[model samples]
Target: MINDKSFIHYLKEAEQDFSGWDFSYVTDTGRMAASLLSWSYGSMAKKLITEATSLLDMGTGGGELLAKLQPFPHSVFATEGYKPNFPISKKRLHPLGVTVVEVDEDNLLPFTNGQFDLIINKHEAYSAQEVRRVISENGIFLTQQVGGADCAEINEALGIPLNQEYLHWQLDFAKKELEDNGFRVVFAKEETPVQRFYDVGALVYYLKAIPWQIPDFEMGDYMEQLYGIHRKIESKGYFDVTQERFIIKAEPI
Candidate 1:
């Protein structure tokens, strides 16, 4: 172990309290950034909300994105699977006339059949059958999912095996599942954009922020590899990785 002060400082700087699916600390400071996709989920959701009477936001983390698209429909609801985020979602969305529910299992939604006409999900898992049951006949189910291959390069960098469980989670796989669940797909697209980290600290922070990226990750376990990445960043200026994203808009047939 190097046990150097500079390295310790980087780890200390990276050890930040991340909450509500927010990564502004590193992103806003130019330490790390991801290339923009051709489509914007917010713009699409905003337009959908204007047309629908009832809306459901699945996994409304901290209600960050949902709150931005204000002047919501008559019945607005949000569901969060994470326990910690349930309170945060309620506190932020409740006052705005949004009913936030805590859902432990995505397959079993605690809602009546045909309860919503517009359902929007970002980076959240859902059962197509359950969605079809809860959404009205004319309902729209729009989702933006992170592919199983999302940032796998980071795993390779750290000498960690790719998460096998999620490795096959791609656009085609998702689209087929929705279709099988009695949905007619309208719009669908996929993208693998570039994501760059300018420093080792930023990478550390990002890995910490998203624990699933490296399951049970600890600074001590990857010290040497991190130091190597630190040297590479020092020489090459940035560590680049591919980010997988896909969008699907479907309606019940």
Candidate 2:
């Protein structure tokens, strides 16, 4: 078990603001590492954007990634469902002529039918029907999703029950869903990359940043498990977990 002083220090640092979708603070510290998928989501999206007259980026957190793909199409739009990220996305994307729109989680996209020729979604939730409605007949939809069974090893290490919500969220299910909604599956791939945390602080920060990983993740409630994992990390140099991810490209039929 880590000492009281070290434990407190880690907890305090992990509790800092996690605004936007940025994870550089923990990742750059050399305490966390993960494997990459064979395909590149950014490169594919950028290439498609260059070929399209209009484009939409869904769930653009703080518009960080979108801003990087400069020299955008004449009509560039982005939607963010999370309230806190709306202003941040606007501040970053507006100067680049990208319109940042705030959207309700339950409502349809606030755009006319067949508005965009290309739509890109990275780690975001989307409605298949809504995507079909807004996209042009020949439009392309490219998305990279965090699969439901991601980080099962973390739950195992913590001695917590696995969350059943994402048990069937595989590549096959995603492809079938899009096909059912009038999309022809073009490219689909899934990978379970191993992620390693070299320190307890990195693990805590990751879980805090992604609350859905463990809904009731209270430090007090899981102190024993945390310490056990900490001991393992101290001995083995890292704690490893598999992360589920998938990417798909579909065109409306």
Candidate 3:
């Protein structure tokens, strides 16, 4: 039984609006943290942005990360496919002189050929052909993807069935896809880092925020498992899970 008053407090905190792609709520609480990979996505992206005159940030989410890359290029553009995030992205990016566009994940982008000299994507799906269509000749494409098997341990912990969709979303598969789309793969790396949750409430908040991790997640339905996991946390200090991540840099051939 979850008898502690803190348990209810954390559960309520986890149920708030996760409108943007931000995770500061859980992260700031020091309830959860992940080990870093060998490479840094922000550093690499900053270097590329410094050199490009025109740039595009796909799936810019609330433009939180993009906003930090200030002193931007002459032309900076961002796209958000999730409708709820569109207005958020615009509000955060528009004042920075970044054009925030609403895009359909499955459709072609609205720009003309060779529109941007650099394109950056982080944890967003893209149609390779459409990316090729919009990028200028010799343009650079940098993307950091969340591997399909990311956080599979979470599913295992909760006795949830694993999905097959992301089984092949590793670095090699991403590189091959880009090459097949006429992009010359320049750099690629993959890492499976360990993440630790200090409390059951953190795990609950995470699953609730990123629903895809546990598509059918519900406190009522998984109460037994949650209680079991809570007991484990009380004994072990934390719950550990692995997260898959990969980064690829390419250029149109």
User: 1 or 3: which has the higher lDDT?
Assistant: 1
Candidate 3's error at 39, in angstroms? 0.8
Indicate which candidate wins on TM-score.
1
Predicted model with the maximum lDDT: 1
Report the lDDT tens digits of candidate 3 across residue range 1-253: 6676665665666677787888787798788999989999899999999999999999999899999988799999999988888999999999999999998863479898999999999999888888988999979999999998888888998898778887888889889888998899999989999999999888998898777889878887787787777878889999999999999999999
Between candidates 1 and 2, name the one with more favorable TM-score.
Answer: 1
Please provide, for model 1 over 1-253, each residue's C-alpha lDDT reduced to its tens digit, 9 standing for 90 to 100.
Answer: 6876766778889989877878899999999999999999999999999999999999999898999999899999999988778888899999999999999899999999999999999999999999999999989999999999899889998999988999889999999999999999999999999999998889999998787999998988999999988878878989999999999999999
Q: Where does the lowest 10-residue lDDT sum fall in candidate 3? A: 5-14
| List of clashing residue pairs for candidate 2 | none
Comparing 1 with 2 on lDDT, the higher-scoring candidate is 1
Question: Candidate 2, residues 1-253: lDDT per residue as tens digits?
Answer: 5476766677767776777788788898888999888999999998999899999999999898999987899999999988888999999999999999899862489999999999999998899899999999989999999888899989988888777877888889999999999999999999989999988888998888787889878887888888888878778988999999999999999
User: How do these models rank on lDDT, best leading?
Assistant: 1, 2, 3
Ranking by TM-score: 1, 3, 2
Query: Candidate 2: what lDDT?
Result: 0.89
Clash totals for all models, in order? 0, 0, 0
